[model samples]
Target: MALVKVFSGSEILAQSLKVRIEAAGVNVIVKNNIQSSNMAGFGSLGQAVEVFIEDKDKEKAAQAIEDFKMGN
Candidate 1:
């Protein structure tokens, strides 16, 4: 199995946060997407998204994400 980077989860902050972070430089292949969990118009959050990346670039990938969040 490949590495799974949790960009977002059951929350918005976590969802976009992850994307902005990785998008800094590393390749962001949105594996899963954040969407409505169930059939309803009440709850909405990071449904589920997956992105693939080189194992070696994991560190850089993580940093890019952090920087993106910190607005660096």
Candidate 2:
């Protein structure tokens, strides 16, 4: 199964998105999470968190992300 990038953002937002996507039955992998974990004061502001999902589930993942953005 090919993986596709669904979202990229701050660690907190990425984690939140991960949870939402998983709840929708889509698998998620997070990149740069370790980097965010090691960030110190003022270091996290520039750190990026990336979220990936199976290519087939991209649409569902995107919907979940958009719903999260809309506070749904």
TM per candidate: 0.41, 0.73
lDDT score of residue 23 within candidate 1:
62
Residue 55 lDDT (model 1): 61
- Stretches of candidate 1 above 4 Å error? 9-25, 33-46
| Residue 13, candidate 2: alpha-carbon lDDT | 85
Cα lDDT tens digits for candidate 1, 9-37: 44445556556645666555454443433
- For candidate 1, the per-residue lDDT at 71 reads 65
- Reference-based lDDT, residue 69, model 1: 57
Q: Clashes per prediction?
A: 7, 0
Give the Cα lDDT of each candidate.
0.55, 0.82
Candidate 2 residue lDDT tens string, 20-69: 99998899999985575566434454547888899998777777888988
Looking at model 1, residue 68 earns an lDDT score of: 51
